[model samples]
Target: MTATVAATKAYDISGNVLKEDLRDIIYDISPMDTIFMTRAGRGTAKSTTHEWLTDTLAAVNAKNAAIEGDAFGAVARTLPSRLKNYTQIARKDFEVTGTAQKTSNAGMRELMAYHTAQASKEIKRDMEAGLLSDEPASAGTSVSARVAAGAEAWIYAPNHISVNQSAATTTAPVSGFATSPVTDGTATAFTSAGLNSMLQQAWSMGGEVDTILVGPTLYNTISAFTGIATRFRDVGSRQQAQIIGAADVYVSAFGSHNIVLSRWARATTVFCLDMSTWEVAYLRPFQTVDIAKVGDAERKALLAEYTLVAKSPMANTKATSMS
Candidate 1:
């Protein structure tokens, strides 16, 4: 598939080059991968790089849309929103602390906490069991309680993109991911002969997708090409949902028979081929480490621990943003 544009930047030896820069390459790792995470952290913290990234995403999206003649607004709105949400959530969690029966995450004064506190004050029945009692028909766990208690209310937001299924087997694939299919033009859909054509066009431009998520509609479309749809149905009947480090959306397409393909996306963690360096494994819902049962502390720790990243910024590489 087409190589992403950003990856083609000529080696910038302007940065500090060791006097003895003998450049012994690390096994199974990218040159930038060894430095981007730290660099990006430095970059984002600087504010300029972060602004550049937001703008770059916008420019790229606009250009892509212009060429395809599709509405760029969908992706334009999506990119900023996604980036803001990710950064905001990460920031809040990064500075959280709690102790004893009391707890505080982010700023306690945020108002969400106030409503929760108010609701808890009203939880007067069956303190020993620690579960909500069947005492009154008035109170419930719904957000309405918080709203009545003066908490602001908002709808449950929907994610813009979905992660397709790809085995998280040794490690979650991270690099050479969205690297494929870097073409600016867009095809309305990919199916039967159409997908092959898309792949060919992508190859003409460079490399394409490393993994993908396929809904039943798209799954059946790809199945006709791969011929593995029947094999998938015979054994794994339920959609083996994976809590991919990369995906924002859940693979709700359950059942082995009815399901056609897995939801996969670009990588969420550093896609290191060297398994030894990364002992951490991809998380699924009910695996040895089910993300579902994890408490806030555990979840934060989990995220901090396994968020494998190259030393430099992945943004330097073109990241795929779905519209």
Candidate 2:
């Protein structure tokens, strides 16, 4: 066979081509805002043992007496109706593996993505869960014990008037209710009268329930509610189409409330919130700490030492049993 001239071959590395569109696409789109909680209040806890007193019960009475007849009569001193505690710590941690720390650069923070914004999201998500749940925390070995008097555990304590799913069952109060608390089952569909009654009851007791929070299921149910006023702009052009089916406001005889659909809220419950009486009492505001080096990995953690403060459980009402 005749010898041939030297042949040339090509390799992928020969070309200086740009990398495939490594566009970091993040799809985490759950509502992570502490909207209802923030609307309630914000404060700094003086110490790990944060305490606040709810105002005395509404007991003003009209009495018939001469101008000076009972002016000197002894009246009982009005003490704080209920005492509450803000003594819970919520925290999370984020660690970067040594390899990831040195070889990751897809998102904004590169290796610190999880440490910064993602870590914040993690903490915020948990806060939302605590804000919307009826969970009770029994101080862990690492965490402080919940104050036993009242407002012991989480933000949405079981103290609120929780209309149970079982209509026959009743929810007893941890302490005397601010007034006659709402106690009604919601295992079925929501009704205009039912909602109106709850609103009226709360309003009568001096609570301004200006917000109604619901889960996706109830959101759809509310959107379909006949009582919800539907407002739309007329698009005269036949070719133009408009989308509807959003419930932004609900006007009742008692008061008008802003309706909000929450992703993290419980599907079986709806909250009639008086945002003015809620608070996020921070023992230690959200901050990141750099851990001491224990391995080749770079370690960081997001920390938030805080607790929910429900000034008065009576100020809020919840409808449970929603299936």
**Residue 181 CA error for candidate 1 (Å)?**
18
Residue-wise C-alpha lDDT for candidate 1, range 1-323, written one tens digit per residue: 98686663435443545243444332333111111121112212221111111222333354432556656454325442211100110111221223422542233443334433333323211121111111111122434321000000000001011123222111111221111112212223443343333223323322222323333345444444442333332335565744322222212122111221322212221111111111111121111122232344322211111112112111111111211
Task: For candidate 1, give the lDDT.
Answer: 0.23
Model 1: per-residue Cα lDDT at residue 288? 19
Cα lDDT tens digits for candidate 2, 9-69:
3444346554566777566665666666557588888765556776756466677447855
Q: Which ten residues in a row have the lowest lDDT in candidate 2?
A: 147-156
Model 2, residue 94: what's the lDDT? 66
- Give TM per candidate: 0.23, 0.77
Q: Mark the regions of model 1 whose C-alpha exceeds 4 Å error after superposition.
A: 1-190, 226-323
**Model 2, residue pairs in steric clash:** none
